[model samples]
Target: MERTFVKDWRGVHKAALALILRCIADHGSPPSPAELQVATAAPSAETVQHMLQEMESRGLIFRDPGSGSILAAYPLSAVPTPHRVRLADGRQVQAMCAVDALGVALVFGQDTHISSRCRHCRADIEVSVVGERIGAYSPASAVVWYTPAAVHCAVAAEGQCPYINFFCSREHVKDWKRDLSAPRGQILPLERALDRARAVFNPMKGLGGGPS
Candidate 1:
């Protein structure tokens, strides 16, 4: 493994860790520095790379040579190849930006189309928050983590977001598309708890037996 000097940003950083987890949970991939740049509205690309390198060295993520982007630290399956995003409509839109950090900042990818799937993978590139969709067809969505049992729910669809209610199991999740006018952020505490748990997915398993 290529060893990189990493800085210690320790102990339950809700933002960074949440971003990392949200990336994989939703998009099936990690967010890159460039994506971070757009999401954070960074001044320059190099600044995003610098901070990203810091996170990478700390064993939270790995940089991919194929795309020159950051990927999750865990040994992942081959990126759900040819993953495409089909919109709510019958049209197949190209996806460029991918905001995976559940609910921090929006993450984007290399494709500039912003309306179609990436040429490389077909994962849903756009995301929507609240009633507004992020890319094109994404609806009010929230990635919720049910505590203890580790159930991860990432939903982007029409109707009210059932994830707002806190329940032990199955009540609200079954109704993800109910009441269209339900107040948002009602389930924020549940989201916060899930975001806090992202530290468990640390990328520092030691890059081994692969590209270095």
Candidate 2:
């Protein structure tokens, strides 16, 4: 297994970041800069924007170009991804990726309803997760595959592809791999996937841990 490490969150206020996350969990999105200034006691809206830019440079967050609002940071996203998780308490949120989708279940310790569509066929793939086991699956044969350590090359603008996904069958994944001509990822069981998400997104539990 590859090692996992937390990102450096310097030049960003830890309490401010924590408050932002708390707001997301409660409100489904980060508060606007003006609202944040009141909530976090930030110096000014301009200073908050500067702080956001610093966090973005460090890969700890992504902000909108026009409004400077947060698009995504770790477990949360303003724009939706393939993975959607619904908690038992009726709260719903989108995750950054598949791993983060399951991480939401682990972080909340709730029975979760996870849903995503097969990228190749556009067929709905859904699963219910109780603790670590799949409580139910629609097709009863769906499998998840993920790259353990997907690489990223900012200079060449390569290696930044979607790393995890569900497939109806191994044959579907085989067909999909013909385009990339790269090794496919290993199948991940539900429990292992959830554990991996916790390691990346919620490593510190009650303590404040920045995005991986």
Candidate 3:
């Protein structure tokens, strides 16, 4: 299948985006508009809200319709997911997918420990990412199943995040794929998956507040 990368972020507010991501990494949750206004020194809460709306429009975030609070800020998620990451700073947060879990360390420029389960068998998997390399991981045979979104898919998180997953091994990936009438993606080695994660998230580093 063809690859579909992240959208361009030219018009998105780097500072605000950075600040929001930092808040999520540091606090395990997204900041309120009032909090963001105070942190970014925006003119008012209304301005912060507008900024958030812009971020949403650009596919940088997903928000709750009822409260207008952020549910995800890409890579990091406010709601729990299969992939959980523990930062070097001792705070824990949820990643949107397997690649997002690996990208956490690169995005923050810190070490991270990931705890997740295999997509097929649900067996526990753990990985340690140090600097730009994969330090260690359980079930040495682990691999990533990557399914990029359609070229015209509107939102990254909504379009393909759910399908990008970690399996205990390539054998499990094949087993899972066999059940599908037509499997439509690639099975990536751990290192290559990390590269994809880096490509997706590394640019966000230092954009607003410089990771924590």
Candidate 4:
């Protein structure tokens, strides 16, 4: 893991981040600077914009390259993905990626219900979360694989990649390999997978074994 120091909260406002997240939860996406200004009443729209820019630059969130609106912040995604994290509070949010679904539960400090489809079989896979403990994955035993962030700068790009997958079992992974052009990712057990998710959400922890 390269020491890419993420100075958490330096020159950033927790309230601003919370406001953006609240917008996402309420509106299904981040508000525009104008909307954010109206919602936060943060003196001016420019101030809100500056705070957003600072957040993105600090790796606290990922913004849309074109719109500059919040695209993602860890477990939450402005754009929907197959991975969904349903909070115990009854608020559901889409995750940026497979590992991110797990990170969502960790970040909120609540039980979560993760729902996604297997990359190969397309069979529904669901996992339960109780605090830090993860329940047995549905569709039987499963393994998660991803390219470690330490090796590749973009562990997850703008869209889904074959590198991130959930195999109902190792045999299914082998079955999928036959048709692939190239192979990638390291298969991880449930516990190690959760640990990797923790490292991913905590940039200060640096890279882990895999993304999710």
Candidate 5:
């Protein structure tokens, strides 16, 4: 999937998107339209809902069909996923994918502990993020599988997030790929994966007033 930097958004849009991410990081769920209206000082709930729809259209977020509650706000997912992230403040949340787990620290400007399983072997993988640097990770050979979604695809959570995953090692990545007969995805080193994540999430810091 294409990464959107903070510079690409309008001020209000940035603040709104930042607020949504902060809400998920702090409360383990996305904010309701009323909450977003109050936090963003949007004119009304209808306006907040419209903004959310715009964000969804831009692929910055995803919402439920019936209730319109946010299902995802980029990297973060309201529902549980394979990648779990524990923030510096002890709050735990789900990430949309492996790279999203790596991006959590940068987005929140806090240390993060990511717990996930290798896609192929189901081996537990633990990664520590201190500031913007990767602290320690198990199985030193751990790698990330980056599968970008098709350009015309709608709803990244369905198209791309499920495919990006952590593998215990390069060999396991190959094993899983061959067994599933999946198309080749980029095999990224942890550091390079972190770099890609930073490009996608780091710029949002300080945009929505620091999480509360």
Candidate 6:
């Protein structure tokens, strides 16, 4: 992990990317950095500029030159990974988590949903590519209790990828799904989502006696 991002990431040059990561951890995808600067009430223009440079040098993020927007990042791996747990409900969840390059975790998860994170980098300037992990079940494993609005999604009957099968309350899953658009809005690709869902999530060493 890069020390630059931690000590002075609240608002800096690439503040857009830092904000993006925070937003993604919570809402996933987000408004532009300009919009974020205004929203977060960043200190000064120079501060934002410096932060961007710092992020780029550290290789914590990727960026889009044209749009000047932050791409996704491994919040934990990029920063310091947070912890994930499995619950008795048979779902894996992380607390306000993010994945870094090595895949570190960050504690997140407020209410209803969590905020995701993204990074901005100087490399890959010619292209526009942006990107963007979690957990098992336990008494404390229930993340919905922390977020309150958590619903359930059914994972693989055999107990695979906790991200899709992470087990949100059906109502919560329905609520989260309702936010999607059209075909994508109604359906969730747990399997596909699993591909990107690794890092932060860890199934219980021994859990899940049945399937959903």
Tell me, by lDDT, which candidate is best.
5
Query: Which order, best to worst by TM-score?
Result: 5, 3, 4, 2, 6, 1
Flag the better candidate by TM-score, 2 or 3: 3
Each prediction's Cα lDDT score? Answer: 0.33, 0.60, 0.74, 0.64, 0.75, 0.32
Query: What's the residue-level lDDT of 126 in candidate 2?
Result: 83
If scored against the real structure, what TM-score would every candidate get?
0.29, 0.72, 0.83, 0.76, 0.85, 0.31
Summarize candidate 2's per-residue lDDT along 86-140 as a digit string, tens digits.
8777777666666766666555556678887675675787878786456787666
How far in Å is the alpha carbon of 65 misplaced in model 4? 2.0
Candidate 4 versus the native: TM-score? 0.76
lDDT of 5 by residue, 48-157 (tens): 77777888887788787888888887678877787899887777878888888888787777788999999899999999988678889998999998876621122354
**C-alpha lDDT (0 to 100) for residue 178 of candidate 5:** 82
Looking at model 5, the pairs that clash are none
Best by TM-score: 5
RMSD of 3: 6.7
Whole-structure CA lDDT of model 3: 0.74
Angstrom error at residue 16, model 2: 3.7
For model 4, give the 10-residue run with minimal summed lDDT: 203-212
Off by over 4 Å in 2: 1-14, 22-28, 132-134, 149-161, 181-184, 204-212
Ranking by lDDT: 5, 3, 4, 2, 1, 6
Those runs of model 3 whose alpha carbons end farther than 4 Å from true positions after fitting are 1-12, 150-160, 181-183, 206-212
Looking at model 1, residue 207 earns an lDDT score of 15
